[model samples]
Target: MKHLRELTSLPTTGLYAAIGTFDGVHTGHQQLIQAMVNQAQKTSTECAVITFFPIPAIVIRNIQTPITLTSPEEKAALFEKLGLNYTITLQFTKEMAQLTPTEFIDLLVSNLPIKQIWVGEDFTFGHQRRGNTTVLSQLGMQYGFETIIVKHFLQNSEKISSSQIRNWLTSGDLESANKALGRPYSITGVVKHGDQRGSKIGFPTANLAVWEGKLLPASGVYATFAQVEGKIYTSVTNIGFRPTFVDNEPNAQVECYIHNFDRNIYDLPVQLFLVSRIRAEKRFESISALIQQIKNDAAKSEEILKHAEFQTGLLTGSTKTAP
Candidate 1:
């Protein structure tokens, strides 16, 4: 996909576009983008996806949310995978956030050939979210472009949303969240050198420090899968400060000890797919105690992943897949 970082960089006028933060690009977001693609194909116009960098919420509210399912790079990659003609990512700023509904539309229509716009039914924009489907519909008529609003997608009668996915993740409900996301929710990070404590304990782990601003699941031990060197493996992951080893560190961490596997993976990028929660993180009284618990956790993780299968409308179908 051609990534246009600025509106002035747009090379053509007739574009069909959809706009959103698209943080997770979950099932609902995919539906919206698919609708945009279908519209573009019907109109024979260039299909573009417009999203903002530094998500409006983070830029405006100064909140450091956790790492998302898809980073900006991953989002663009997914757009390319979906065959979008272009991907436009803008840097959110105070000035841009102040634009009125009409002004925002004018900024795009005046710079490009915008023949159609697609967004979710609950989409909002402009100063203080003053713009909505009503405003876009009115402007579409005035600008001679078509506007389409996709109704909210649902699963189990609940709206499939980014927030809901985040909640499921935070609660370690990976199976439920994956059902809503159409795939396993994963976090990618570089494998770092750890304390080697796991090696001493017979469970050598790959320490993963995720990219900044990535959301992490709740602090606990979980059944997970790790992808390293293009190969996937079953694993157990711990996300939290290692209270058993130390008590003063404030930041939590993610460490995965792959089961039935052993190889050097330091500095390699790995993606961890959480499958199920096994237990809460706790402080063990001794190293031997902790090691024994880890053994149990690892065994349970294997069984959980062996039977783990996501259902609902999101997944393509049901199959017993490890993680």
Candidate 2:
């Protein structure tokens, strides 16, 4: 797929496009994108996902905390995996937010030969989110294009959304979140050097430098698959401040001890897929106690991965792009 940063030079035309933030590209997003892809393929039209970076909510709502589930690069990779011909990352800015519905539609219409626009029933856009599916359809008519509204994808009567999945992750409900996402919830980051406390304890961990605004799962020990250098390793991951060793940490840290591995992977990118929550993070009484718990966590993670079927989505080696 051609992952373009701007619409200035689109590689192809006659586009069947879906426009959204598509934070995690969860199950709901997958279905909608797949539907568009299927129809685009049948009609022999190039398809694209027009998404915004720094997401609209962060800019409009002035959100101060980390809430993104996927980074722009990660989303582009996911879009490519979904068989899209193009993944356009629009650089969202405060000035762009001032555009009216007509202006926004005009911008897209001016850029490419958009044959059809696909969006969810409740999708909104334009200044102050005044534009809805109805407004989009009207604009489509004016611009000589078709608008398709996809129904909400529901699970137990609740619509699967990025916000809902965030709540699930914050609550440590990996099962529900993974079900909604159609894959294990993952965090991708570069490995950086940390305090070497884990090494002293005989559990050397790869400290991850995750994106600033990305939301992390609840503070806990989790069974995870760590993808590094194109290999998947069973791992025990911790996402929380080490209260036992330090106090008042400024941010949550992700540290994972890969099982049966010993290599200097610092500065390399690693993706951790949380399989299940083993236990909540806690302050141990002593260093020995913490070491013991780490051993237990590793054993449990190994057992969990042993019985679980191999998962495929979003892993580095498993990803494929449209031809």
Candidate 3:
């Protein structure tokens, strides 16, 4: 997908666009995006997407601890997979937020030959949030374009939303979050250095620097896998500061011990797909007790990950006991 970093004056021809943050691109979002692509195809125009970064909430409310469902890079990869022709990530600024509904629509119509526009039922924009489907259609007619509003996609009688997904993840309901997302939620980043504490415990780990602003699941041990060079390996990951060692820290850490594998993987890229939460992290009485519990955690991880793999058909790495 052509990533348009320049927000202003986008050179375009025959573009049909969808506009939203599309953070997780849940099932509802997938339907909206696919409809946009289909409309673009019917009109013989390019399928494009536009979103604002730093999130409207963070920019407007100044949320102290802002968490994102998808990192910018992750969102790009997903949109590309969904067969979009281009994605324009505009930096959210105070000035842009001040545009009136008509002004924003005029901006889009002027910049690109927008043949059609797609959005979800709850989608709205412009100053004081005055934009809606009705206003959008009126503007579309004035600009000689079409507007499409997709129905809210639902699962189990409830609307699937990114906020709902975040609640599920925060509550450690990986299955529910995955159900709404139509795929396992994952985090991708480069492996970074950590205190060599895991080495002394005989269960070395790959410390990962998670994507900034990406929301992490609840603080616990998780049954997961690591993807490196297209090969998958069974992994047990911890997603909290070592409560057994550290106390009252502001930052949380993510690190995973790859079972049955030994290699220097620091500084390499890896994607960790969290399959299931194993247990909440706890402080042990002694180092010996902690070591023993880790061994049990490894066994439990393999079992849970194998079951999840069979159910989801993803990351079926070695499930047997690691030598």
Best of the candidates, lDDT: 2
* Least accurate 10 contiguous residues by lDDT in model 2: 314-323
Give one digit per residue, the lDDT tens place, for model 3 in 1-323.
78876545545567778999888878888889988887677867788888878778778777767479886667777788778998888888888889999999888777777888898988898987899889999998999988888999999999999999999998889889988888778877788988999998899999998776889888899888777766677899999878887888578889899998888988899888787888988888799999999999999998877766522222233344323
**Candidate 1 displacement at residue 264 in angstroms:** 1.9
Clash pairs for candidate 1: 13-113, 14-113, 66-213, 66-214, 66-215, 67-213, 67-214, 67-215
TM-score: model 3 vs. ground truth? 0.92
RMSD of candidates 1 onward, in order: 3.0, 3.3, 2.9
Q: Which scores better on lDDT, 1 or 2?
A: 2
lDDT of each: 0.82, 0.89, 0.82
TM-score for each candidate, following the candidate numbering: 0.89, 0.96, 0.92
lDDT, candidate 1, at 97: 90
Model 1 lDDT per residue over 1-323, tens place: 79878886466658888989888788888888987887677877788988988778876787775546667777887787666999888888989999999999999888778888899999999999999999999999999888989999999999998888889888878678877777767778899988899898888988987887788888899888776776667889999999999879678899999987777888999888777788989999999999899999999998987776533223334444343
What clash pairs does model 3 have? none
